[model samples]
Target: MSTLLLRLAAPMQSWGISSKFNRRTTNMEPTRSGVIGMLAAAMGMSREDSLDVFNPLRFGVRIDQPGTMNRDFQVVYQNPDDILPTWLTYRYYLEDAVFLAGLEGPSGFLAELEAALMHPVYPLALGRRSCPPAEPLVLGIRDVDLLTALRQEEWQASSWYQRKAKWQNITSLEIVRDASPDESGYAVRDVPESFSQKRRLYRFRNVIREQVFLDQLVSSENTENEQGTPKEHDPMELLEDDDVSIKSQNQ
Candidate 1:
């Protein structure tokens, strides 16, 4: 087995689980379904395609930088003349966050995915089409289990955020991962059963959550590398962008 590491840092990201019409909300961190959707897109899998290929993969994530939350407003008008605030809703997302995602699977399939990510068949997004990810998305393959791989990976938080954490003397980071058959964990409805837009589906998944001490993680210079490093000039990269733009959509 092998683990594929992903540096899911984006200026803006939204991973919604129970989001529906009117108001869409984001989860605190990356969701498995959201991540899998991106992967499926990378492989050019259409909405009607089977998502069975992704079912066997075990997942885990380490929150290096838990970012601030931001909201978006969307308005709708039945017609040009009918515009008295007919519809208004709020959408929430995470700003300037960094996550180290690990997917454990067979080496061959993992390798295939690694290459596909490098040259994705379809454009990738961080939860939503408006939120694209930054460079160095694929952190390469790790020859370890899901939990160990995430634990051994280097810190992915921005430099300034790291400094702030150090000053505050923060020692641990939140770690969440898919639970094994014998492992106990809380249940979340994130496991992807289907990606068909016509009738989107998801199943319950148990995930183990724990705190990993800062010392237990590897430190790095945050350089851009295959092993998941940030760009040299990354501050929040928030001021700049991965070419991210926001436009109000008519719901």
Candidate 2:
């Protein structure tokens, strides 16, 4: 059992889980669906073949560092009509996406999987259209136990990381990377350049549901919460118990 860590930082990234038309895009949290889509794209899997690899993923996520929770707009289209003014709108969501998983079986298959992710043939959307990744996303793969420990520690310390965690029956584990300098340099806080051709600029709107889901995904990787009954205290906690300490003064 190994885990994969991925770096998804990009200059122009958007992960829209639930967005509607007229470019009224709402950035949604990076969902299992969205992440899997990214994997499929990297692997060049056709729509028909994507689910075979995506549907049964045992999943967990830890957001080690959260990016600026900001939103920006992109002008999709515009028209001038005194009778009816309209603009195409799109929403962008920026949430640090992380994932961990155990493989289905066979260590030999890792190379194939990594190759697929490293050079995906399809267009990878982190979670939204407006938030397309800026460059090559980063990924790290390792064993489940080690990954779990690291993930748990990350979760314990941050409110942002404690969100966006999800549970799935993982068949395998693969992390995506942003290796392109231009693409990776983009951040969520960036505002797209305005187009002179457009008659209007549509402002992207933020939705709370996206935030909640993003948080849910990161917060879901809880090994302690899943099965283990809470031990009375951590070993360090026990040492701090002033009443339980026996001073060793054997000088």
Candidate 3:
């Protein structure tokens, strides 16, 4: 079987894997589902289209470059009329986010996939909720496999991804490795340090972390389908943010 390598990176991208809250959210890294969705969209697949083509394929993600993920949170006031005595807080947090993904399949299918991704019959999203892909590159691989070749490449190789033994039975995997921002690959660099520092001036890192934690708690507590009733929490929570409570302890 052959494989296709697609390079996805953008200045401001968002991949809301399981975001549930008033504030905007972003995935820590690009998601297999999101990438498939992007391809489906380019193929003019409707939201209801079946994803069987991509559902069973072997997949993996590599952290080529980490981009800053900044999301704004809105704090609602208790009283609409009250201004001076209003009790509300709103802010945003910025964190580094970057990832690379590899997909393997039949050679013909791989070629079609690469062309579809490059020309993108339609549109493409780097890996963000709000940002669209500006420049995406596709590398054709016939003799070498994606993960195998990537591991050998010196540009952004990582020991974690180099071990073939660890890849046994792993249809898919994601590696968050250290990468220099200067490396040539897919990367995002829109939210400058000045903006992040300016926002930090208004809200302490501890406070912002707390707010993120509170927002997660509130989100978990307020799960519903527009009627304000709780629904069954899915296992995909693994993809959700880590415990915000720990942020308090650090402070």
Candidate 4:
């Protein structure tokens, strides 16, 4: 199988799974349905078109930069009359996040997708229409499986983030991939049945989570480990530390 890698970095993204009326939520990572929708748009496939063709492709995403979540408020007026009340809604988004996504399938099919992504028929969005992705979305195609490509790929986080984190010292990254039902994994309702806006449909998929070591790109730079390498940059390492702080604040 061949893998098509995508650099999914955006200023704002929202991958909602169970969002309803006034409140929309977001997942920490990109969702399968969202990725499929973007692919469909790239190929100029309408909502009524069959997504089954792409369903068999193995999908996976590596979190290169886990961004912070923030919420926004909106107010909508129902009627022109001054007496009418306003509707309040809250939307959540991931700010400045970056993900390395992989799609493994037949070499020919992946080649077509890689081309389409470069010259997409329709505009692409991260998750919502308002959220446009940064340039260079098409990373490249690899002659390897989804998991291997995801594991071996270099970090795709923003340059600023990498410099702030001193990525040279990082050894590996974490990845989550679609797993078969027979395998032990987390269940997520992101599989798309039909993307028709009028009648959206979805199913479930099993996800296997694991960590992959960074390649020589990182190790080579850190080989010296000399005093010149500044130890102050630690944004990536601060992820865990910030998480703990948030949880503690909640408690």
TM-score of each: 0.88, 0.47, 0.51, 0.81
Count steric clashes of candidate 2.
Answer: 55
In model 4, what lDDT does residue 223 have? 28
Question: Candidate 1 lDDT, tens digit per residue, 120-168?
Answer: 9999999999998887788789899998988888888887898999999
Local distance difference test, each candidate:
0.88, 0.40, 0.47, 0.83
- Per-residue lDDT, model 1, residue 162, is 88
| Between candidates 1 and 2, the lDDT winner | 1
Q: Residue 225 lDDT in model 2?
A: 60
Off by over 4 Å in 1: 79-85, 222-251
Model 4 residue 122 lDDT score: 97
Q: What would the per-residue lDDT of candidate 4 be over residues 190-226, giving only the tens digit for each residue?
A: 9999999799999988899988765523342342253
Rank by lDDT, descending?
1, 4, 3, 2
Per-residue lDDT, model 4, residue 157, is 71
Largest TM-score belongs to which candidate?
A: 1
Ten contiguous residues minimizing lDDT sum, candidate 3 = 203-212
Tens-place lDDT per residue, model 2, 166-202, is 2332222222222122333222321112212342122
RMSD per candidate (Å) reads 6.9, 16.9, 21.6, 11.1
lDDT score, candidate 1: 0.88
Task: Quote model 2's TM-score.
Answer: 0.47
